[model samples]
Target chain A: DVKVTQSSRYLVKRTGEKVFLECVQDMDHENMFWYRQDPGLGLRLIYFSYDVKMKEKGDIPEGYSVSREKKERFSLILESASTNQTSMYLCASSYRREDYYGYTFGSGTRLTVV
Target chain B: AQSVTQPDIHITVSEGASLELRCNYSYGATPYLFWYVQSPGQGLQLLLKYFSGDTLVQGIKGFEAEFKRSQSSFNLRKPSVHWSDAAEYFCAVGSSASKIIFGSGTRLSIRP
Candidate 1:
């Protein structure tokens, strides 16, 4: 079955450390997104890419950046980790056509910043 | 601004009983509506979606949702809920754009 794979399921990083969370999709989807899931807040979009080397900021894009070097790979970067940044990070992918079909998500990477 | 609202933060229901989770949306036009379930420590799975045509849509695991344009609501219902159905349900709305707005989510707990 097709899937979105996140490289890490859990991670602990120190404050002020640079962190990288990787995601890869096998479905050849053109759109990829990163969202942070928090209790009582649900999931909030951080960034999304519609094509390679292209990215757009979502509702909550502060303290985050993204890279799409290849069509199948999208990476989320934390310039400097903070305690507030600790949350369940989810990666998802979908077709270029908007809302034609729902997104396929990765198992998610829960990060903790100390 | 487009947004989704799942008013109930938590719901408890006995197994083998009927279930309903409410969801409402506010958008400029007829939007794409979806219901997603996230089991403990798992990714969100699409329960069902409504784009157009029939207002009522069937989804996996015997779940269904009905779209009421006049009410701007798309509520999920199940004839009977199982123990395995305990999970967090999120309601979402999407426009013709790339992003989808998700509600805060409702956590469902099944009682014995």
Candidate 2:
């Protein structure tokens, strides 16, 4: 079974603090993604990594950065956490394929920026 | 760029009633489609997917979806609704490895 693990289930941080959301996958998938889910906006992509040390910006990547130093791990970094960044963050991983087989997502981390 | 649209933001159904959630996608070519359900405070789970061949696909937890090429839609349906089926459903379209889009999502509410 494929398991994606997110380090934190819930987090509270003060404004302007640096926040790190970590994710790890056991499936050895080549693609990993970070997304933030909001009520009306839905799940918007923050960043994605196709391979180790390679990263791509998603639709909403301005306030976030990502690191994939290892294949099994992907970390999302908030340079300066703000109250607007408070939301449920999700991590997903999938095999590189022409046909989408869907992603294995981790239990999201609900971050509260005060 | 690929995009998805879920028309309904929320739906309410009584237990044992039939339910359907609408989803539409816009892509240049034949696209990969998927339906995912996320329980409150949990991760999203794959409900179903459509690649090719059969337009109708069955998934976990008694959920199924149909791919309509002409309509550019992939709607999820269930014959009967259960209380545990209450969750947020998202429809997604994948055009390429880097070009996948998810709909805003439809929140389902079940009443007894």
Per-residue lDDT tens digits for candidate 2, residues A36-97, read: 99998888999998999999999999989999999999999999999999999999999884
Candidate 1 residue-wise lDDT, B1-112, digit = tens? 9999999999999999999999999999889998999999989988998889999999999999999999999999999999999999999999853778999999999998
Q: What are the RMSD figures for all models against the true structure?
A: 0.9, 1.1
Off by over 4 Å in 1: none
Pairs that collide, model 2: none
Interface RMSD of 1: 1.6
DockQ of 1: 0.67
lDDT of 2 by residue, B1-112 (tens): 6889999999999999999999989998999898999999999998988888999999999999999999999999999999999999999988764556789999999999
Query: What DockQ do you compute for every candidate structure?
Result: 0.67, 0.68
Prediction-by-prediction clash tally? 0, 0
lDDT of 1 at A62: 97
**TM-score for each of the candidates:** 0.98, 0.97
What value does DockQ give for candidate 2? 0.68
Each model's lDDT = 0.94, 0.92
- Count of backbone collisions within predicted model 2: 0
